[model samples]
Target: MAETTNDTATLDCLIAGGGYVGLSVAVAVKHAAPHMNVLVVDAAPEDALSTDERASAIAAAASRMLGQLGLWEDMLKEAQPINEMIVTDSRTTDPVRPVFLTFGDVNEESNEPFAHMVPNKVLVGALRGKAKEVGVTILHGETVDDFITSDPTSEITLGSGKKLRTRLLIAADGVRSSLRDKAGIRTVHWDYDQMGLVTTVSHERPHHGRAEEHFLPGGPFATLPLPDKDGKHRSSLVWTEPTANAKRLMEAGDFTFELELESRFGHKLGEISVAGPRKAFPLGLTLARDFIRHRFALVGDAAHGIHPIAGQGLNLGFKDAAALAQTIVEADRLGLDIGMETVLERYQLWRRFDTVQMGLVTDMLNRLFSNDITPLRMVRSFGLGLVDRMPGIKKMFIDQAAGRAGTNPALLNGEAI
Candidate 1:
C-alpha cells in the first residue's frame, strides 16, 4: 500500500495514470534517483488491472529495460517468446493462404527471439509491485482533475478536492487523455473506421512460438502465441474489421462468432475455441503536436497513439518512458530543474520524430492492406516478396521490430540512467 501524501509538501514528480507507462516512469525515476519523491495517481479502481485479459508484445529492447529494472525475471516465467513470424495475404474465405514473408530469429549471432507475448495483468502487477518496492507512492481510485503550472511547480487538484504540488507532472493517461486536453495539447487525429477485436483461444495443438499475421480485405488478423495454461495450448488474437462488422461479430453468439473466426483463422492449429471474453477497441491515429509545456510532459498514448497493425503501440510507450526518465534523471543529477521547458524539450525532440515516422508507417501499411484493389494488392505483394528475398532488407526490418535501430536512450539499451 502507498503512503498518504501531505498536501503542503511538494513532490519531485507526480504522475497521472498508473498503467504500464505511468508506473514505469515512477519506478524508473525513483529507482535511479532515490532521493526524488514520486507519486502516481490512477483513476481506475485498485483491482482494475488484475482483470485485464488482453496481452501485449514486449519487444527485445523493452524486455531488456525490464530486466535492468529487476522485473523481467518474474515476467519471463509467463511470457511466450515469438520464435518466428509469417505474413500472408488472402481473403477470409480462401481455403489456402500463401505466406508472403517470413522472419526467423532476430539475428544469427544472438539467436534471441525478437519479442514476447505477455499478459497485461502480469505486466501491470509486476510494475505495481516494483513501484511499491522502489518507494514510489501510488494513489488508486484518484485522478488529477486539473492543474495550474507555475514557474517551479504545477499545483494539481484531485477529483476528491485535495491538492498537491509537484516539480514535474507527467501524463500517461492513455489515448483519450483528459490531461493532455487540459494542457492545451492539440493533436493530428483521424479515425480508421475500424475496430480491433481482441480475445484468447485454445487450440488442439501448440503454436510452437510462431506468430501469424494475415492481411484480409477488411484488416489484419494477428494470432500470437501464448504460454500454455493447465496443459492447454492457447493463443492471443487481434482481429481487425470495419466498425459495423466488428460490433456485429461481437454481438453474435459464440457459435456464430467461432464460425466467422474460423474463416480467418483456418485449421492451421487444428480445432479451436474462444477461451476468453471478446472486446473491441476502436482504431485511430492520434499524434500530439507538442509533447511538453511549462512543467508538464506527455508520455505513452497521451503523446501518440498509432494503429496496432505492427504490435508496436505498447513498445512505443516504453520508449517514451525510457527517454523521459533518462532526461529527468540526468537533469536532476546536473542540478537543473527537471520540469522546465528547456529540460522537457530534450525529451520531446528525441521522441517526436520517431513517433511521427512510426505513425505514418503504420497508417500507410493499414491503408495499403485493408482493401482488395487488385492493383494495390499486386504492388504490396510484390513489395513483400522482394523484401523477403533480400536478406539485408529483412534483417533491417527485424532490427526495427526489435527496437534496436535508432538513437536510443540508455535505459532502452539495458543500461542504468
Candidate 2:
C-alpha cells in the first residue's frame, strides 16, 4: 500500500504519527512554522526500516529538544552521555545499602551531558534528516483510517486510499491513539502490572558515563550507559519487572538469560553480555482526558503515558514538543489560531502541571518500589540517606535530573525561538 496525494493544496499542518512523538511533532511544527505545509504520516509495514526498535531516554529535557532541533550535533556520535545517575537499593538485604538516587553533574553550567542514550533509530534519523532539510513532508506507507473537519481545515481518509485536506491536526498518534479514537478523545488507561524490558549489554567493565538505578522488589531496574562495539564497555537495559517476571525473563535460556542479566547488571558492570535483541513493553498509566479538541492537538503517546521510572518517557514528549512549539510559535506571531482553542489552551496550560507532576512522581515510584514494604521500606530508605547527606539537597537532586528544573520551554532550554 503506497499512497500519496497532494493536489488540493492549502494545507499547513497534518502530522499524524511517524513515531518518536510523530517525528518530533513534525519537526517541532516545521521548526516553528516555516511557511507551513508540514505533512508527516506513518502506518509502517512497507518493509519498515527508517529504524527504531525502542531505546529512548534522551532527557536533559530531551537533550535540549535535540539541541533545539538542530539534531544534537549528529546525535552525539552514537550517543552515551549520561554523565551520572546512580540510584540503587537493590532489593532489601539492607545493611544500610541505600543510595536511592544520585544524578551527578549532567550539565550544570556548560559542563554538558545530562542525558543522551540515542537509538530510536538514531533519534529518528536526526529528526528525519532535519525534516528533509527544512521541507518536512514524510509520507511513509500512509494511515489515518478516517476523518473530517472544517472551520479552518482537516479532512483525511486513508487506510491506504489516499485523501487529505488539512489546516491543522496533530496527534502524535501512539499509545492507542487512532487519531485519538478518531477525534472523539477519551482515555484514562491503566495496566502497570509492569513490563519495560529493553536490551543491549556487553560489558567487561565500563559504563563510566554512568546511570544505574536498581530498586528491585520487581520493578525499576534501569542500567543505561552505552557505546561499545567491542570498545570494551556498554549497557542499555531498563528491566522493570513483574509481568510474570518479564515473561520469565523473556523465556530464559540465552545462557539462562545471560545469567539473569548478569545478576542485575553485575553491580556496576564487571560482567553483562547480551548485546541486543530482547524487548517487551507494557507498563502504563495513560491519561488523555482531553488534550485539545477541534482542529486537533495531542502530542506524544497521544497525550501522556508516564513512568519509565524517571527517564520521563521521552522527557515527557520533549516537554510536549517544547510546549507545543512554544504555543504555536507565540500564537503564530500574533495572528493566533495555530489550531485555536486559544492556541490549544497554551498546550493545556503548559502541560497540565508537568503532566500531573510527572504522574504523581511515577505513581509514587511505582507504588514505592513495587512493595516489599517494611514501613515504606523505612521511609524511602531514610529519605535516600537524607538526600545523601544533603549537599544542598544533592544539588537539588542533580538539578532536577538535569532537565534543569521546571518552567523551561525554549525547546527545553537548548533554545531557539
Q: What local distance difference test score does each model get?
A: 0.93, 0.75
After superposition, the stretches of candidate 2 with alpha carbons farther than 4 Å from their true spots are 1-9, 12-19, 24-117, 133-150, 154-166, 171-213, 216-221, 229-232, 236-268, 271-286, 310-365, 368-372, 375-417
TM-scores across all candidates?
Answer: 0.99, 0.34
Instruction: Give a tens-digit lDDT track for model 1, residues 1-417.
Output: 238766786898999999999999999999899999999999998899767877899999899899899999999999999999999998887778989999976477676689999999999999999998999999999999999999678899999988899999999999999999999999999999999999999999999999999999999999999999888999999999999999999999999999999889999899999999999999999999999998999999999999999999899999999999999999999999999999999999999999999999999999999999999999998999998999999999988998888999888888999
Residue pairs in candidate 1 whose N, alpha carbon or C atoms collide under 3 angstroms: none
Q: Which 10-residue window of candidate 1 scores lowest in summed lDDT?
A: 1-10
Top candidate, metric TM-score: 1
Count of clashing residue pairs in every prediction: 0, 0
- Which structure among the candidates has the greatest lDDT? 1
Query: lDDT tens digits, residues 325-401, model 2?
Result: 77777777888778767678878888877776777788888988777868887887788877877778787666666
lDDT of 2: 0.75
Q: Which residue pairs does candidate 2 place in steric collision?
A: none
